[model samples]
Each structure stands twice: as C-alpha cells, then as structure tokens.
Target: MSKNRFFACIRSSFFSRLLMGVVAAAITGTACAAGEAWPKEINLGYQKYGPLIILKSTGELEKRLKEHGVTVNWAEFQFGPPMLEALNAGSLDFAVTGETPPVAAQAAKGSPLVYVASEPASPQGEGIVVKADSELKTIADLKGKKVAVAKGSNAHFFLIQALAKAGLTLDDISVAYLAPADARAALERGDVAAWSIWDYFYAAAEIQLGVRALANGEGIVNNYAFYTSRRDFVEQYPALIDVVLDEVRKTDQWVKNNPVEASEKLAAHVSIDAKILEKALRRSNYGPEPLKPEVTAAQQKIADTLLAIKLLPYQINVQDAVWQPKGK
Candidate 1:
C-alpha cells in the first residue's frame, strides 16, 4: 500500500474512536443527572397523628407500592424533629411531619430534604394549657413563668406566636424544653406554669388532667403538616410520590367523612380515650394539598421568625427545598 493511504487509514480510525468516547460520556452524564435507581423498599416515618396512621392501618400504602415491587417499612416517631432526623440520615426515604420541622431540617447544612405535599392548617389541633385554677388566665401572664415546649416542634412555634400576640417575646418567659410526655408530668406536678402541646396529648390533658387552655393556636399559628422525602428519592421516583400522596389524600377524605369511626380507630391504636380522640378529631380538618406558593410563604415566615429569635443558625429559603415534579 502507498504511504499516504496508510497514514490516512490510521487517522480515520483515531477520529472514529474519539467520537464514540464523546457519545458514551454524554449518555453517562445524562443518566447521573436523571438520578439514582429505585430501591426494593422505602421507609416511611409517621407520628401517631394524621392520615399516615390511617394509611398504615389499612395497608393501602403497602398495596400500592407492592404493585411496583417496592416493599414498605414503617417507623413511628413521637414528634416531627426526630422523624426529620431519620429522614436526614437516609434511614427514612419518605415521612410526614409538622411544617416547622421541614424548615428546621432545611436550615441545617447538607440536608437533602424536600417538601412534596402538605395538610391544611388545623390550628385548633394544638395549644398551650394551664391548670384549670392557675392564675395565669392570659398569654401575657406567662411572663417570667416557666413554660414547657418541645424545642423544635410545631408547639414551639405556637408558643412563640401566642407570646408575641400577647406582647411577650420568648425572652419574656423562662423556657423549659421538654417533650410532651415530660412536659405533661411537669404540668401535673406544678413544676411548670403551662405546657404547649398537640393532640391527643393536649386533649387528654384537657379532659383527664383538667388543664384549661391558656391560649390555643386559633389565630396565632397555622399548624400545617408536611410530607417530605430525600431529594434523590423524589427525583428518581416522582410517580411513586404521586401515588403516595393520592393514597393519603384518599385517607384524609375518609376521615373527613367518618369522623366518629376514624377517632375510634385511632384511639384503639394509640390507646387514648375515645372521647378525647373525638374532641381532637372534631376540630381537625383532614385534607392534603400540594406545595403551593402561599404554603411556602407561610413556611418562610416561620423560618424567619426563628432566625429573628436566633434559634436558627442561618437563613433558609423554603422554596429552595420544595420539590418540583418532572415537567411541572
């Protein structure tokens, strides 16, 4: 063969191999951008409240996920903060929590969490309670009093707002950080002036302990619940998230339709008195919604409130942690 022909053939082979390498690199990059693959099982965390308990009792979530070859594992949390911790640790793929917990979780660095859905504000579900005969008849009366509240839960925000409306700041009161169980003990022992809590604990305290509400959420705070997932899980399985939300929405509707039966069922699971459950459930509005602009705004307000009080380390934009489904 001629020298020119030999050199030309070698150059052609080199260019062809380079072109294939470029195409292969592009495909891998696209796949990575798309996200991780689905796992055989997904973990969900829930507190005793809300439609999650109903979903769990009925096995609807398992049935839906099972169709896709994904099994469901459930974990129960006493409050939103710890449930969010599990989510941040990747031990939970999906979970539901009160609104404030998501903001707190997102404010922490390296948290790959995103809010997917939320329940409407049912402010009456939570409140501050004092002994029926306590002289602390108003929120302003809490000044200089030792008040019990969960550090990062919804009740924390409720107490903050109630105090603010009463022209009192968190600084005005001696804050006692306690969980619902311990807080109830303190309240019963007269160790704390009041306890900020959510139901069925709040209901039980009202009926069983004869603790009268000093101030309820009502106009002070909007107690919205949120469903969140790891960012990767949301990106990879948007459809699955939709299915879970749909099922939960259905459960909410069922609760709304059968309030009595719903309360009785939940009372059985949590072993709380049925009458107290009924009182709590009566005041609740069970509806799940997608993350809307107004909801995000309210969440941002809560984050800003915490930041103002120096409770949050840094500012967080709630919209940044919001999950936008594919093609939305």
Candidate 2:
C-alpha cells in the first residue's frame, strides 16, 4: 500500500521476467546445438552392383546405420556416373560409383567428393564381352564390328583398353552406345557382336547367352565401385563415416567368404539371374581397401584415358578430390 513497497514489488517482477527470458534463450540455444529431433537419414546411391545390391537386400547396411539413429535411404541409379551426379547435386549423402565418374563429377561439381572405400576389381574382370558363338575374340576383332557398351562407363574404358591392347583404337570399333539393358539385348540378338560390361550382366550373357570374356580389365583397368561421401559430410560427422567404412569392411568380407549364398542374396536386386551371379561371383574381388596412391593412380589413369579419348571436358585434380582414409 505504501509507495516504496509498490516500487519494490514492481522491480522484483521485472527482474524475475528478465531472468526467465535468459533461461528460455539458453534452452533455445541448446536445442539448436543438439540438432533437430530425428537423426539424419543417409541417402545412399547404388547401381545394382552385387555387393551393393547384397548390402541393401540383406538389410545389413540398414541394420548397421540404425545403430547411429541414421536411417538408410537407398537410391538406385542406372550407372556410376549418375550415382555420383546425385551425390554432387546434394540428393545423396553417399553413393557407389566407379573410379572414373567421381573424377569427372568432381571436376564438374568442384565439390570435394572423396572415396571412402572401394571394392577391388573382379579377378576375372570386365571387358568387351561377346557371344560365345560370335567371332569377335579380341579388340582387333572389334574393328568394324559393332560393340555395345555404356557410354562414359567404365565399360567404355575397358573397350578403349581392349582396343589399345589389341593394336586398334576407339575409332576402329563401331561403338553401339547403349544402356546396360539394351546392350544385353543387342549382344543376344547379335545386333552387336560384342558387349562391354561388368559383374552380373557380364556373367549372365556368359551363362545364358553363351558370351565369352574377350579381355580381362581386372589387372588392367576398368570400373571398380567406390563408396564415396562429401568432404563436408566427413568434417561434420567424422564418426559416421568411420561407421560406414567399418560396415563396408564387414560386408566385403562376408561377400568374399560365402560366394554361392551371396550370389543368391543378390539375385532379387540385379537384372541377371542368380546362376549368372554365381558364375560372376568368382570374378569379383569384394575386399575393400581404403583409397591408396596406387588405387588413385589407377583411377587417374582412367580419367586421363577419358580425357585423351575426349569423353571428359578436361582432366581433374584427383588427388585433391580424394579423402584420406581414416585408418592411416
């Protein structure tokens, strides 16, 4: 009722309001730091390759990712280059692609797309494959012969190398630029005497269509899949990438040890039959190694090959694009 009492009461109320505001601000700041309610969902791109297909179909990757509160969202692409494109466009957090697409994408996107891991080349290898009954036995055999291979694909590199090894050139071969599906049909119908392909399809033709492997690009060079993530992703979530790499390690070993059963696991995902995959499984080297200098050198060679062949706009600085493996 007194003037001093009224002023003192008003001051106390003001102080209490100010203190509440500060506490609310601190809580809001804390909320922002902790990120949104749900953990991020990792979008992974793949191209129906056996190991990747198996990784997805068997639910191993999803199970592994769930532990981190990261849900696995799988996106399938037609080829490695497209997968890498999706990754560069920010639609994908991680994806699998061959050695060349990342190089070309990194050059085009200017974003540092680092190779987190790689599935070693198939021991039997990818190449300019042809029907068994067909007469195309070598790259020299491809001269004036129509060859079906995916353009800008690692198969493209295989054809180039196959041509070079046999003393012909890309100009010598009549390249039938087709997607993997059409390419398979072209080879089956004898529309194109040869088809350059990898893994399942390559094996499918061998079993069903009686195709023969004309050349081996394993020890030579060809499209080997890479599990790649953005450099920014690694910086922000280093441990997440490590978990991915660790999962990759576990799966790669499983894929190698159990061949027949693993092929059966991949049957549903790929176009090729399980029998074909079983045959092709023998060729694949699924053991993962971190991107090493020799590996980069091999990839750089493919990039250079593309540049020299005029498929790419220009050569990319691959060393900078590559992310150092955490193990080292």
Candidate 3:
C-alpha cells in the first residue's frame, strides 16, 4: 500500500457500512456524541492482549477486507474500556475488550455494542500476578499494598474478587488504575506490588519479568475477553460482522491447532520469549459461543460485583449484548 493510502486507511475506514472515524475529542459510541453521523468505512480497533493480535500482525484481515474495498483500519489500544471509549465516540467500528469494560460502557449509556465472539475462560489462569520475589503471596497479602489494573477491564474484576477472597475491600489496597503498559512498567520498576492483566501482556510479564501470579482466578471468576462491535455497525453491516467473527474464529482455530507456530508468532509480535509465549498461549482458552449462558452468568457476576461496588450505575442487560449469526 502506498504511504498516502496507508495513512488514509489508518485515519478512517469502512467495511460495507462499518466506519471508524478518527477524531480529536473523547467519544463513547458508534454515532458521534454530537449525533454527527456514522461513516461508511470500517475501522477495526484492537489491543495487544486479544488473540487477534496474531491475525493483525499477519496482515490477514486487512488483506481480506481490502478485496471488497472495505479499507481496514487497525488501531491498537492498551485495554478494552478505552478502546470502547473510542468506539463509542465513533472513532472505531469494532474492537475486542474484556467482559468488564463493555458492561461499564453499557451502564454509562455509551453502550451500543454487541458481542462478536468470546474466548475460552481459564479460571485461575487469568489473574493478578506479582514478581516471584515479592512478599505478596496471596490475596490477603495485598491489603494496604498497591494493585495495578486497567480501571474497567476483566483484570479489574480479578482485583475485586481477589480482594474479596482476602476478606478485604477495594479501599484496602491502593488501587493504581493504569493501562497495561503503565501497569507493566510500574510492576517492572517495583512501583506497584501486583499487576492484573490478560494474554500477551500477561505472558510478557511472567516471561520477561519472572512475575508469578499471586492468586489464580479459577473459581474466583472466569476473566474472558470479548470481541465486540458498534451496535449500529453490526446492524447495518451484518455480513461484515460475520466476516470479522469469521476472521477471529480462523485466527483462534489456528492457535488451537498450531501452538508452536502461534507461540513463535505471538512472541515475535509481543517481543517476548517463545517459551513464555507458549505458556500464555496455553492459558488462552478459546470458546465457540461468545454469549453462551454460562458466559453470560460469568459476565453477570462481574457486573453484579461492579454494581455492588458502584462501578456501574445499574444492571446492564448482557443478554442483549450478544450478536448471534443471523439464521444460525
């Protein structure tokens, strides 16, 4: 692609009826906050932790979307909540984030989002971790200590559950609300005692920093990530939503069938060790149903926790958030 075309693709894009309008101000839904309008180009927002990082790095979806002149624009974010922030502002058409961010968004009335798909839930696998050398060994040990997490991520839920397990409250620990990059940096510098994270970012810590999870999330809750799209986009370009889901499924299937190759690719993409990538890859549980009832129940648990803590204004209808294939 020419430099001009690439820049244009990055600035804004369309997938049939999907649009990602890059803007300066803060936004939280597909339609501009000012009710400006939705665009025709498709913009794809993603994060480093999402499994599609592999698909992104491989230039797979871009190549596919280009065939239809659907110009694919990829934006990398630190976590789901902020990415959803962008999508809600109409700056992005689609993205993947953890289960918690969308619920928070939904609570904010910034929620015109629907599930594109879901990944495997490995309880105790995704969680709050600490440097093996740290004195924080269990959830109880985190009391009065600083815990790092993206403010509205699934890891945030982990932090909450982990706190409860320790018989403590959010006020017990000094919550250092930071994105993944900042949290990782702080963890590396011993700025914070513990870090809650998911996938590639999660693997990077265990491998590069020798961080060990202090408490696993097994029975605590399933911290699964989600692929979501703007509600307007899903409705207008249902076929494109299918394409996006298909691409994600293909990428996930590839990871399932070829761990070694997938790990190598992920390691290269994240600049982590292949062995560490392999470990994280093993933790990535792929689920076929994005909004399965069990998954919804799990999401509800997180939602309920958030509500109990007043992180949300009211209960969000997670069932309405799922995007099922038409006629499936």
Which number leads on lDDT? 1
Model 3: lDDT equals 0.77
Residue 322 in candidate 3 has what lDDT? 80
Runs of candidate 1 with Cα error greater than 4 angstroms are 1-38
Q: List the RMSD of every prediction in angstroms.
A: 3.9, 4.1, 12.4
- Order the candidate numbers by TM-score, best to worst: 1, 2, 3
54-154 per-residue lDDT for model 2 (tens digits): 77787877777676688888888877777777788788888876666777787774665877777776536576677777766666777888888877777
User: Compared to the true structure, candidate 3 yields what TM-score?
Assistant: 0.82
Q: Model 1 — TM-score against the truth?
A: 0.89
Tens-digit lDDT string for candidate 3 (1-328): 9999998886665532243333322454443433333334688887664466888888887777776667777888877888888877888888877778888876767567777777777664576899888887788988899888888888888878878887999999899999888999998899999998876677777777888887777778777777788777776676676777788888888988888899888778877678877877787677445577898787777778898888888887788788765556
Q: Encode model 1's per-residue lDDT on 104-179: one tens digit a residue.
A: 9998789999999888888999989999999989999999999999989999999999999999999899999998
TM-score of each: 0.89, 0.84, 0.82
Quote the lDDT for 254 in model 1: 91
Give model 2's clash tally. 0
**lDDT (Cα atoms) of all candidates against the true structure:** 0.88, 0.74, 0.77
